[model samples]
Target: MIIQAVAHRGYPKKYAENTLSSFLKAVELGFSHLELDVHLSKDGIPVVIHDHTLDRMTNGTGRVVDYTASELQSFRVKQDEHIPTLEEVLRALKGKIQLNIELKQMGDYYPELEKRVLEVIEAFDMLDQVVITSFDFDALERIRQLSRDVRIGLITFGGSKAILDWSLEMGATFLSMHYAFVTEHYIQRCQDLGIQLMAWTINESSVMKQFQEYPSVWICTDELEGFMDVLEMSGSI
Candidate 1:
């Protein structure tokens, strides 16, 4: 069995999450897929970073939407790593790896976020190489409205019939769930329903061993190298 592993936020265990260097390093380590978060800057450019606020991941403060993309890039994530624009990330990793771009919003959503993100993806001619994911169903719906060909994934904390129905209704190509919520039965259910399932942020070897049994399922992890080693030891890769 081959475990399909996605480098979650570009190997956050070793580098700053959502930074360009982090993504490039994941590519250097030979990960087939990379997951990242995107929020529209004040100027409406899609920039990569997890939080709607910058306090957690960068030296800056306040809402990400408050700063222009260029202004946001001025803030340092770690020692010197600047926040990257979606275009910059796509330009660098376009042909090298598949990207799982999460459209992020909390409270009030950013205006034209979905449209701007699609424009960026289209600008790079990477619609086939990328999947847009979000916990915000409305945003995913907006993506669906904009382009039928673009792949969409519904991200949720757990699995349930309601979630499945929602994914099906949205015509989502993938269902991304928290690892703790995934089970063999759920895996089989997704397989039976023709929905591709992905488990996220998995780091434990024991968990990796368990998920390896279902080769059709994808796993996203912060510790990509460690998880890969686990799969290698179990002869699942």
Candidate 2:
């Protein structure tokens, strides 16, 4: 079969990344899952965004945590998009797509970050439709403790046997990684263990071909919708 595409930060190439409009566009394009980054706003609300600092994605320039949700709204994302609250994004896409929320931890904000994400997910009653991802095992474990039904992914920038072993022990539902880490052997190994593999930030046609050969290779990318169009045209994916 084909790999399931998880649009990274909701197809950043098409719409402003991580905004409600962006997420809706991916859902409308038939993406069953959309990936997003979560960070606590200045007032402890969970907001959908990818950067610790707002300089890249928004009009304002400062740490995300430095601005309260109200302050964050004043700075628009590119193309005049308001930074939608996580609650708004979730509700907009509710019942339409599974959400993969990557917790971009900054220093010791693990406990607080985990708590805020849980609060919003619970508010939407979407604990079942979400998969929490993080490189911080402590934060992942802490979230694991907080919710039994919510699936979790252990985020890794690089691949290794040791990390694999730990991911198994941690009962991670998915192994999310940088695109370079995906391979035939890696796919086979995960199959043996009944684990799903997901790669992040992929954007090349050749790289997408390498992934298509392995169906277990789920993926997240900003250019995913465009890539899907190419695959359909070529009849390769």
Best by TM-score: 1
**What is the clash count for each candidate, in the order shown?**
0, 0
Point out the worst 10-residue segment of candidate 2 by lDDT.
106-115
**Model 2 Cα lDDT, one tens digit per residue, 1-237:** 333788888867878888888888887778868888888887888888888889998878988888889999888888589887788888888888988898988557634898888888898999878889888888888888887777888888777788778877777868888888666787788788877788887888778767777767786778865678667877855
Candidate 2: C-alpha lDDT: 0.81
Candidate 2 wrong stretches, greater than 4 Å? 1-3, 234-237
lDDT measured at residue 60 in model 1 versus the true structure, 0 to 100: 91
Instruction: For residue 15, give model 2's deviation from the true position in Å.
Output: 1.3
Least well predicted 10-residue stretch by lDDT in candidate 1: 1-10
